[model samples]
Target: MVELQSGYKLKKLRSDRGGEYTSAEFLQFCEEIGLERQLTVAYSPQQNGVAERKNRTIVEMSKTMMKEKKLPYKFWGEAVNTAVYIRDRCPTKALEKVSPFEAFSGRKSGVKHLKVFGSICFCHVPNQLRSKLEDAAVKCIFVGYGKCEKGYRVYNLQTNKITTSRSVIFDENSLWDRDTQTVDSVTVQIRSEDTSRSSEEEHEETMIDIPSPPQVLAHAKCAAHIADTELYG
Candidate 1:
């Protein structure tokens, strides 16, 4: 798209010997564009110092974000994007106090829409489509701002899908944890009932009827006396 839009035929393209850049289609495209493709030596990343530095910076920042937010490893992509997004707008000594966004676009970047990464967010469900039993809003974990798409990247626990949303309600305070309400309550109640039932059963067993030794002896003596009297008569 850039080649087509530029209208000026590309002259030289310098990059690492990556599969995408070295593919036959890319080679053909470069040939068609009258472009020179220059690839750096394999394993000699020092030759590509700028790209290598940026990659290192992104990796370090991404790790920092994940560690800080306590997010899952699968969210590395979102962390990388957030790291790049913030770095792109941060002022540096080389840029003379001007941010990368300002330097590139010649305009100041807006910080109004910025949010904490991994914050809890609630997205409203359309009322017309929502069922009576369904919640009015769906809970989500904020990942980062979308690049190509015009929305924020969010992770939905219920759906297990990382999707984009234009509108959302954010809760920077909350963190994700497993819900144990019903199960825990039910287990406690069941244990209590079991304990009560066990105590009652124990009390009933302790009160079981048993004939006294004195009563049994007295009944046997009376029978023997009656038999003796009948034999003598």
Candidate 2:
């Protein structure tokens, strides 16, 4: 797929010694395709640290994106896809001026149309699909970008599936639930009360507790008495 899209044959594939890469079928396929498999030693990710670190970076970024927008687990695949898309477009020190996407695709990936992943959107329904008196737009959650079309992909709540629309009105400031949100099954955050209380307690513990002047005097006297008793006895 990579070779077909990029118009350049994949010469070498570098990966860790995973079962998927080491399997007979995969090896045979690679040999037939005239591609070299450069496998690192088993359990030594340091040999392939660049690939490992990139995978970790993508996963962490995906997690952050989902959490930041209060997106559900069902949208994790979309989040990961978006993460890779964003990562490719991001400028890296490895490449001067051009992004990874630009370096590979020979053109810059425009960011002008990027929108919040889980923000609420209203997709315009065509006149043929809607009745004369019926509403023209449907509420949806923006999932990702349209691959085949110049539009945004959104998950329709009423239809319970994803659909792409170029005429998408996005309210980036708002999420799926509009001005307010109730307890949503797929997206609500369940935090431990004990953990919250413990954090508050920890904050309090960090502050200096100043003793009263009388208490200070008493403490000083007690220390002096103990010292004097030790010296005398």
Candidate 3:
């Protein structure tokens, strides 16, 4: 992207000594673009005060959120990402009650869509995706907001997969206490009406039996499972 103020082309790149910036492909790209580079000394965070402070704030917020929700260390990445998302939409000390999101986008962001991190949710399984005898919704953990779509990012407990879905019913009021032994899953028999479904259904549903999350660390799976998904998914 070109500079918006003077409309001048980018000429230089100043950054810390990170592996991402020093990669061969990135170096080649910068070279091809004739972008001069000034790399800061290793472990010198003071050279970039704004970014350093922001990173620190995100880390603190993530840690607080994880501990508050009783989520394990394995879900740290998701907590960090969600903390950033929440922070961007919140008022900053540097601004006059303006959020970073509004400062850049030139408009206020919608706050209604925001949900509690690691809350239990029910993702609607479309009629086409399931048979009449099959369940209508799947129980999942609300991890984060969707990146590329207008939806939520959820971790399916039964299928052991991540999915982005607009048709999700969140249960923010219900929280799990870390006391019971870890189990595979629990059954949640929810009595529902036609309006209970996210994607409004024509026919009424008697019961929406979905697998409830076990009373473990809120959204934490085994280290290998959740960490990879939080990083790559």
User: Each model's TM-score, in the order given?
Assistant: 0.66, 0.72, 0.69
Using TM-score as the measure, which candidate wins? 2
Please give the CA lDDT of all the candidate structures: 0.72, 0.74, 0.74
Spell out the clash pairs found in candidate 2: none
- The local lDDT score (0 to 100) that residue 79 gets in candidate 2 is 88
lDDT per residue for candidate 2 within 1-233, as digits (tens), equals 77777898779999987789999999999989899999898889999899899999988988888787787788889988888888888898889867999998888788888887787776767757865445556667888888788888899878889988998766565555423642122323333345556554533323333343233335544554565478778
Better of 1 and 3 by TM-score: 3
After superposition, the stretches of candidate 2 with alpha carbons farther than 4 Å from their true spots are 4-7, 177-233
Question: Each candidate: RMSD to true structure?
Answer: 27.2, 23.3, 13.4
Candidate 3 lDDT by residue in tens digits, 1-233:
33684467888787898899999999999999899987888888888778888899999998987776676787888888899999999987788889988887678998999998877777777757875445566777788988778899987878868889998777764444447623233345555566666675555545544434432223323433454468778
- Runs in model 1 lying further than 4 Å from the true structure: 1-10, 178-233
TM-score: which is higher, 2 or 3? 2
- Worst lDDT run of 10 residues, candidate 2, spans 182-191
